[model samples]
Target: MDVDGRNSTIGYGASASGMTDFSRTDAERANPGHDTRQSFQGDGMRGRVLAIALTLATLIGALPVAGSLWVAWGSANRARTDMLDGAVHEMLARYNRMSTEIDQVFDDLSSLPLAEACEPVGLMRLRTAAYFSRGVREVAVIENGRILCTGAGKSDMPASLPLPDMSEGDVRIWYDRVPPDVRAPASDVARSTVIARNGFALFLDTEQIYDLVLTDPRTVLSMVSLTSRQVMGVRSRPERAMLSDMVDRFRTDPPPRSLRVGNRLIVAAPTADGAAMALAAQPIDVVLEAWRQQAVPLGLLGLTSGAIIFWLILTLARRGDTMGARIRRGLARGEFRVVYQPIVRLSDGACLGGEALVRWQQRDGTMISPDRFIPVAEAEGLIERLTDQIIEHVFADIGKFLAERPTVWIAINLSAPDVESDRVRGRLDRLRKTHGVAADQIVLEATERTLIDARRAQSSMRSFRDAGYRLTIDDFGTGYSSLAYLATLPVDGLKLDKTFVDSIGSGTPADDVMGHILSLAATLGLDVAAEGIEHGAQADYLIARGVTYGQGWLFARAMEAETFGAYVDGRMAVAGPPSRRRRA
Candidate 1:
């Protein structure tokens, strides 16, 4: 019975142990279906949280980024559009100004009686007008294919005037007179249309209108143009584009409440009944360029901030400092000096005077030429002070020289601004009194370029001369020396420009031209002084041909006060061959 029971127990135990399967039960408990579903749900929740965080970040960053970009792009585009539009508008404004000026000129011309137009008084008036209107290359009154009158350079055009074809419309709107080449057919001869009273026209060259309009920077300004759509007479590529775009966009439809081209914004108006359009372009590019340049500073500030931030974060930034302050401080120390160059008489080799030339000495003792700093000084308004200092020094030197030699003359080349200022005259008067120097002992050499206002110059010079001061016209032949003005002006002498003197006997036509000028000056009783006579031959030639005086290297280069004094004292000798001298 015990054996049977033991065997049954063993069998039961074995079966129970085998059926239990502890590892399989543990696996089933750990991975129950409900638990698996809950695990998958947890993982999905985490993934959704990550995606939400990423999407939130993108939204946070991209909104302002896109908005700012849109605002910037829109502003830039508007500014660009405004600039282009403004360019056209400004061009039109310039055209209007030019047109007004032209009308005024015509009015002035017409106001003159027909009889006076050809007289000397008329010529004087015309020449005065021409001088004031220097931009006008030429002026002519053409009547029936013949030039009725001209101020200057009239022979360059055809002797016989040519009339233009005017089938399209009245050509008088564009031209004052017609050339003979474009004269209308005898059968098509219409009665001359009076454009501006005395300003009448028989025909107009459409080509000349285009040429005139295109020459001005304000008209067909520097711009890109589309060749295909260009008007018949419009030569400017940019103008063509502007005109085409304007016509295409604004011709049919009224202008928008506001329009922009480039950076300029402007108002538009229709022109010429139904055929033409006009727009005014204001200078928006300047403003835009300024704004754009400002961004550089802002960007630099941003970079500096970023660098500071980076330094704060990484602890690896350098100190922010520069040498500009030190350099400025050095400049404030006043380390500038002046040198003098003597001007002398050519005939007697007499030291007449000197021009004070300034120099800048750096802290390191390196001297900088006046040409570099003089412009800077002028722009900064420091030139007046500089000039005063130079004048004081010069007057002191002159006083010292005159203490021994009273007959010597000193010429000072004054800047245009100085010459224009009343203070300069006052200073000269004070200097004359202080130095006991007669006004004739000091010569003021002024250039024609500096004489911008003839009336003012005439008045100023007359006053100076009346005060016993001598005035010399310097660089005489270089500019538009009008014969009419030269004949009328009370200038004591003319300084023939170095360019003309240099060109003399160079086998160029200019030599004969200069000879004619010399003759003209002699006839007018004006003293002629030849300038830049570097060669003895040139000086001899000038003196032989009645050139009264000369200044050049042939006699001497500009020298120091001591050397010049020695030359005046007959100690330093000039090594040139004797020149044929003439009296002034």
Candidate 2:
């Protein structure tokens, strides 16, 4: 031992100076030009050997990776083009089918006698015809831009029709504004066209084609006039201007081979009716997703490509460190506060306990959950200090209120170290005595991870019970909880994990697991309290199955101690008591 009472390893001082031998040797070699022909020749051979090895490696490794990437790059483009082409074709095909169906309906309607279309009985026939036709909202008869009559429950047709100047026997599509006098029909489908017969024209519904054809919100299908180049119908609201731009630009100059804007691309194909080009603007993200599956093979090109996993680990470490810093700062600044989530008897909603949940409330009125920061605290060795901070505030804030409601338990969670630590019993005992509250009113929630040393855990839990504090195995069934642990641990109740509770009655395998857990708890004669009972059905399911207590948003969220008092008051006013249901 040194004079300062520090122990020193043998030869520790020698290592500090002896590490400089190579520097002194190099200094000696450089002095006065000491000849080094043999050394130089050896180094030259080594340099050549290293260079040759690196060159061969570069040739072998770079070629395959580069070639693979190049192939993937081309495949990605081809796949992207194919994906967009498929979307465009799908749009065109849908509109074409709608047109074909409408044209068939038009063929049937045009052959009707013009006199019959203008009669009241003929109007009933017209209304019935409009009902049978697909995508037809209302039918009207027109004679040389003059409104004649419509189907039943007549909507005023436009006095002057703006028909696209189509040559005789030629059909065209164009946009026409709906008149304000039109009334909405029962059926939602719409198709409008002026079919000339003799001197009169038949007007059919038009606007509902966008719904019949387009399901995608991003892609737009526009019907453009062949000669006048007017926009007839647009499927999507956002892509309406893009379609107009394409039409205006395509008319002024030769059409651009590719029409793309930022991450959105425009794909156009000739419509089935040959009257318009079906142009659609789709996000490039769709193309990227289609091609992502093909580039996965490039991962096999590098034998040591496992570094991404290491990089991920490092990234997570950095994030943990950032979160750790925030927790440490929070401890200093007192940014965390304890909120109480109500635990109630399942049969009726009565406040039996309040679970202490820590929340980080920033000054800007945003809350960060304990789940995000608790694991970070545990990993960073700051859990004990964090818990201490919360408990101290709780005692200062609500020790008197808890003493008044002696039957209502205030549950606080503990870490693995807390269960085995020497100071826990002393601190808890002191707190209980100081608050003048019985230990039964203090429920310590713990998870299976706290049973690091089973014997020590059992001892600590027994000590807690002897002091009159209730014990709960929190987040039960999530970790190392098993029959052995349950049989051995000295806990009063099992708090069902939220994951299982969320899945209750969902018909998942979790429902079966819940039954198993309940059955096991019953056999062991343990009280069962289920957390995260968000739905009424979940609470009813547990209550019918004899769960002792329930805690979740279905009843109330965690609140301040004063708020909890108000909540309890409200509950007592409605429900009878925490022990049992009141017979009405």
Candidate 3:
């Protein structure tokens, strides 16, 4: 039979039998062509079946391979995030621990009697030297651009060391770049010392901090006068080198503010004294070099796993999958709202103005505390928007309140970052204009930390004052630079920190401290507002002490606008001693 004829015959039976059978024995015997044709047909069928099986097997394997790959990629990303978070947390912990240590050291130094530390005779010098001599590289008494005496081991000192007429920048350059001959060693580290003056007397006993240059081990302490722009004393070469490097780095990038450079971290913070000091630490670059050293094996494993994951996901997606996307959209869509806390006169309980507090309401109807999100918002650059929204709400609330009552001043708390920005002043100006409100009607409450840069703070405060806005130093007693800041900054009012009020009349030594603070504010001729006043006795005590304003749950808790309006209409009266409630 011919090939075409045979195929035509087989085609008819192939549909029903799903097979082909050769029954012509004579033809098979005459030609081996029949067997060859049958063999070729059998091979073709097997090949097709093998191809289909291989393709299906490949797809099945790819699903798990893709899934594994995706999982691996996610794991790698998560690991990196965890590592970075751990590093930041560790750094913060170390920074806090160092701060505590410094505080303890300052406390010890402050506890010493000033009379003993600054005796007219050399006894004070001897005592100072003796106190720090064991680990001290040098000790010098600096007063009015002159070094009175030195405990430096070198013979380079004159009877009286008159400071060189150099600018602060010049001094820093000289100190940082000078040869080791002038610098101190690790064993006898050189430090620059200066006495900070408060009015006429040196403020030594009041937790006053002095600038010191020390070795990496923190052994040798040197003092410098930033005002005088000169080194007061010297010590060993190795110590001086380390101290100079530290001082230079500090001048460039100071503490609380951290800058990362390659594998090293440099941090600088201002001394209780005027000088800026810095510390540097180098962390091993394990993450960056991980790929070259150990990443091949890990990456191969991750890649294989990731491939499996990718395939699994692709299969699931192909099978018609449903997935949800979760994202955190911040306070952009009216998630943040304002709550008003009334600031009232302690004597009459007359509500002067309400401070606008921000509250975040989540989609789930849960209210997130300001303490949690405010910092995050600030970090995320959402503070500017947040501030604007707050100002708008405050002004609107003020407008409503003013329609019913006489003009009242509203104080709004600003973050240090916001207050420090030049744009803040402009924003405030615009807000004032938009609301048709006078600057006096709105008080900006900034903490001492907000005024870290004295020059900038002075400039900003002056601008606010010139614009006719009231500025209050918020949480006054809690800051390190409160008293010194009050003397310098242009502020109209002082808001006593809550800690002081909470501790009042507890019959503890802290009460005496609080009383002194109240007296101090009164002496300064600044208006005082006792914040967080909870008890009647505390309120009465504060009122007697001439605190003009008070806030907290003592008189009334923070209420809604309607409730506050009613309270104001009723003019809730507070009975107290006239002395305590005296208005400024």
Candidate 4:
């Protein structure tokens, strides 16, 4: 059989028994065959193997993403929570700390008694107050709108930025916009009290306000005055005015407490004085980027899985024999024979091995594909028998070649039913012993479904692993449940489904998913064999990305066992001297 599903003349049984040797030596031709065997039919898919494969892929992509994300998110949330709480706590602490520090100054200014209209003693009292309240930049006496003597001498207050008319308030805040620095954009504030149209003012640092609000380096904060429509510690005057309007609107209707201001999360917390608001702003994209990184392959899982199952279901729906009794009879008549697809090592294109695929050439001339019959065998309790026939015929065809070139291997597929029932192990042990083939000379293939069911058939799947046979997950990344299977299953390698190999370098949506699958397989320390590679570019991509082996039309298609043997023998002859020298 060739890749086009065409028949070919190979080694023996071209008509009598449908068996074509995978590998044959001339000496075996002279001897009568040990057993003249058989015919069989099979189709596939149950136990949700593909579904489990996908579940595992998603979980792999999700874990680092989810873990990094959850940790980053949870850490960010915790940091935000702590900073907001700290900002509030420090805001109140400053209010109290300043209150205690300035209380004596406020009392002294209020009680110093009105020094008679610009009296020199007024200057003396101003000096005394300034000395007591170091927070005060200057002390001033204002009598009937005339600036009296102050702590620094005759006063000339900037008339343009004059203090607003004061009224009754315990502690008043007003900006002294005198001698502004254009480069710095900073302003000073004066705290004052009035006595009978005359007042004494004390100046304080405005940066103290800036420090009180902006608590964390990653965030910005602003305090807006509801009564005056003024904002302190904000960057621009217009921004202050805009924030004032927002704060005013918010106070009237304060539901939906947080607002977005250009990628930043703006949250408002009212101050202790009830006269102002404290707004904290942080970017939301920090968490969004984290989620996006992990979600790169999320869409591929659904699209690929649907395509796989839909094709399988459509294939399974076709008319074919699925019963055990029929398969038993078919096995006896030799209706089934083995075809081999050469597994090529990506590094050097060497023939690593071949996977044995069963093809049923029914007597009526209707060829039943494996997809049409394997599932029915499993559901009908005939998978074990089908496997037995496949194993026996595959080794029979390849037996003599393997005996000569002991290093060469052949892989055969087994299912969950084969593993769960222990029938596969018994047959393999007996056959390998009879053929005198080392355990390493044969590879046992199973889907993730087998490993997941392996717990039940532990003795079977484990026996394959323990006895040195390479066990692989067939059609990997096609389903959603193999995550747990990877950790617990005693498998040795992963066979990437054709879908991933097909999408290689197409710039298709599945590209990222394929990269992720390859990365995950590597991370698990499993060697990967890519299936369905049909293009040079695809082969190049998989090889560059660390694929160990590949099987597809890109190399040679599935062929009769005899053709595969010839191919392998030829390759070996070409590389034989150097290989032998290296071994020597």
Candidate 5:
């Protein structure tokens, strides 16, 4: 009656002084195990579905970040490979030029170098060869431990030479050999490389092997001997152990081109002649930098996608929960039942009629309260179907009983949508004709809230009244209940809301309002039915105030069709004699 049928004119009685005893005894006496049969078992299934949706959303959101991380790692590796390839390209270019220059120097000195030895002609040829070659710093003649001649002038000093660092067939190469200028500081002087064959040697700076200019200062470039695994020339100082490890790893039969050592990445490329290897070393942070650049957008995209998916699932789940889908299923399964609460005359306690209330007991025996599903039915536009079902249940349960007892009437609560349509009237007409029940015996009750659009409700109430049906404004004093508002509607009676009735002796301001409501109903010449009357004092007060009809636990709680019929029959017998009266 109150939006969700919680305060429907015809539902089970609320707890008062005597309702506890009445509810238990009436339920057990009328239909055993009926009260214990209803539950909210579907809640567990709904909870699990929600939990699963949340977990899936979380996983879905994290997937993109995971994929991004993988992509970032790949990007970092590619960057390292590019750096290695660039370093290798530069080293190969310089090696090619140095090799070409050395060949030219050898050719220039080949004509007269060995025979002339320390002579003027040999010295002149050496100076000319040194001048023609860009890589060669000096062209000299050496034999055993003695320097015979030099490109600049005759060399009288002893040739201090050690075993060659690497030997390729007839050629011997000295890496980082001491320079001839002893006056220069060791740090200031560039280390030299000496390549000797026969009685001749070409003096070249070790830097010429790998003269690198890298964009990343953290990068280190070194030239390593492929055969001996020796680091020959380095552009930057790196740890000796790391260099050794790199050499050991790259010294395989076909050597690895790249590898990671500790926090550094090492890349190697063999020179064209295969005599030297270009090694590029850099910290792992370079790879991380690449990863960072790519991770931010991917992570955001993943998070965004995850959030959207979660919202969609949650929306769908909530819709499934509240869209009255389950209510429809419950209806199809015949989970709904109809019960009646007696409405008696306050003066004699005579059971004149009763109000029909709908109860939904699921297949599992769990009862879904009308308060939980009635508003959902209205919101989903399924109130008409629910009303039709209740009407059918009412007639099916007590049609013949009502026919035999013509004076007793049953009030059925209606929703706002029901008042707005002619469907209820049509259904009522068909049922009344089919069952031979008088239209006046079935009263239609609408709460004051249903008449928000006064003109429409006035017309609908008038139509029902014209069809010989009793119409009452139920749950009065709870909504629009001003004298002006009530006077405009066509209704046979006014049903006082439980709030005002409960305030009868509470000494609250609402108690005063109840008097005003009774006065208004009397002034409008409408019969009054007090709902939720439990105590004797309340009934005495209503009777004294001229409230003709009253219903609550003081009389009887809502009961099944058979029990209600039995109660009516017993009351009729006790009342005796025939006293013709109009339905209240």
Candidate 6:
């Protein structure tokens, strides 16, 4: 048969059996050319092989990324646990100090030869004991919960003590107390924790018990009485339900443990005496944030082995995932820059120095406000990196200028975590040494909130001052602090908050506070710098009140390093020194 006729008649039905012959042989026989079944099987086998190859490739590509994510998550969880453990350890150390002091005071008081506690000799001995005790504010002799006499003197009247908050055998504890003859302000006297036993009571400061340096700022520390389920002392405000649950868990004096309660991770340890417990609580989201921070580098490292498609998707997703991620990327790309706001003498308007303020600008020429990104950086524990970048940029921008002008000082803001850590101080010292910048020429500024642990903050600032670096409190009066709180911090100057300056001459209650702040600064002999002084009247008011330094729009807004250098040059050319101008 011809090839065309055979092809046309292929797979035809109705053979001798009068049934359709649907076999592949019929087609193959009619054509007498290729094997149709073999061709079909070969194509199917090729498809199966290709699918298996793709599947294997996908699994191989995903393994690394999956491993990275697992490792990152594990590290984050371990970090959270470690942080909680640290906080608990710190609280226990505090408790140990307090308990040791209590034991010492009780022993000293017990050894005193006292016939009558209300008499002159006994009062003198009590006073001497109180003088030596660090935690004891007052030592008193009590009878049936009534104060008979104290180190201050004999009570004019018998003052009845309130019922104890925690009573265990012979020991009694009052969580909050205000005894008679506490002449200090009501606020100061309200936080006293009284521990009484064997006819004597020691009025202890609650701060001694609860002032802990928590690893995470959001972590809350508290001392709770396991028996009474009452909070003996607390550092920051805690959720009501969380506190209640925590107290309930320790009713039977459980051993030290870390457990998740609702949305918080709580690490708790009991006091040595088993009467009280210390707990540190942090949010779960904070832990997840820590995970995200660790995941960035890990994920990048893993993506090298991932499929090109996955790499592309991850890159695009991370590009806009979070502000923290954006900041991290921005820092890597050198998108952060510095600007200087001139600090001038209120008397002559001659620039004495400038404050280094950090600014962020993306590659696309988009400006991100400090108010927006700063909090994100803080929350993500990237503030130290941001501060490092700011410091580097500052020195690069104006290090030589500062070296030439001995009188000019540039103030740099320090975040709370920076104040808590030694990294920033070390970085600053190295930069100063490298750039020939005088320690005094660069002022380190910390806000009131930076004093999270007042004792530690004081020690940190003292180290700075000892190194000859000046310290200033920025944004004063904006936090939960008063002028008196300044005495606790080792600082040379304070920048009045803009809100206080804006309320200048507004005849509001804040005006009164401003007056009080000025008076307090003057009394303390602290250098006062008024911020946001936009009006002559405001400047005049501050200058008249003896504010020597001021920075605001009245003199000039923040400018780039080049502009600021020219600004100071022009100011010096016109105004000269106050002494020189007066002589002229």
Query: Against the hidden true structure, what lDDT does model 6 obtain?
Result: 0.70
Q: Which stretches of candidate 3 lie over 4 Å from their true place?
A: 1-279, 282-304, 307-328, 421-436, 507-512, 572-584
Error (Å) of candidate 1 at residue 260 is: 4.2
The C-alpha lDDT values of all candidates are 0.48, 0.59, 0.48, 0.57, 0.72, 0.70
- lDDT, candidate 5, 43-95, per-residue tens: 66677878887997787677767886786678778877787777876676667
Candidate 3 TM-score over all chains jointly: 0.54
Best by TM-score: 6
Compare candidates 1 and 6 on lDDT and give the better one. Answer: 6
Residue lDDT tens for model 3, 356-452: 6655554554444333344445545566677777777666666556534435666777765556666777877886676666666777887654554
User: After aligning candidate 6 to the native by TM-score, how far in Å is the CA of 215 from where it should be?
Assistant: 27
Give the Å error, residue 347, model 1.
Answer: 4.2
Off by over 4 Å in 5: 1-323, 573-584
User: Residue 278 error for model 4, in Å?
Assistant: 53
Model 2 TM-score (2 dp)? 0.44
Range of the 10 consecutive residues with the lowest summed lDDT in candidate 6: 14-23
The superposed Cα distance between candidate 5 and the true structure at residue 333, in angstroms, equals 1.9
Give lDDT: candidate 1, residue 169: 38
- TM per candidate: 0.55, 0.44, 0.54, 0.44, 0.49, 0.57
> How does candidate 6 fare on TM-score?
0.57
Task: Select the stronger candidate by lDDT from 3 and 5.
Answer: 5
Best by lDDT: 5
Worst 10 residues of 2 by lDDT: 16-25
Residue 157's lDDT in candidate 5: 66
Count steric clashes of candidate 1: 34
Estimate, for each residue in 349-414, the C-alpha lDDT of model 4 and write its tens digit. Answer: 888678887776656544554433455565566666777788888778988777677767888877
Candidate 6 residue 345 Cα shift, in angstroms, is 1.1
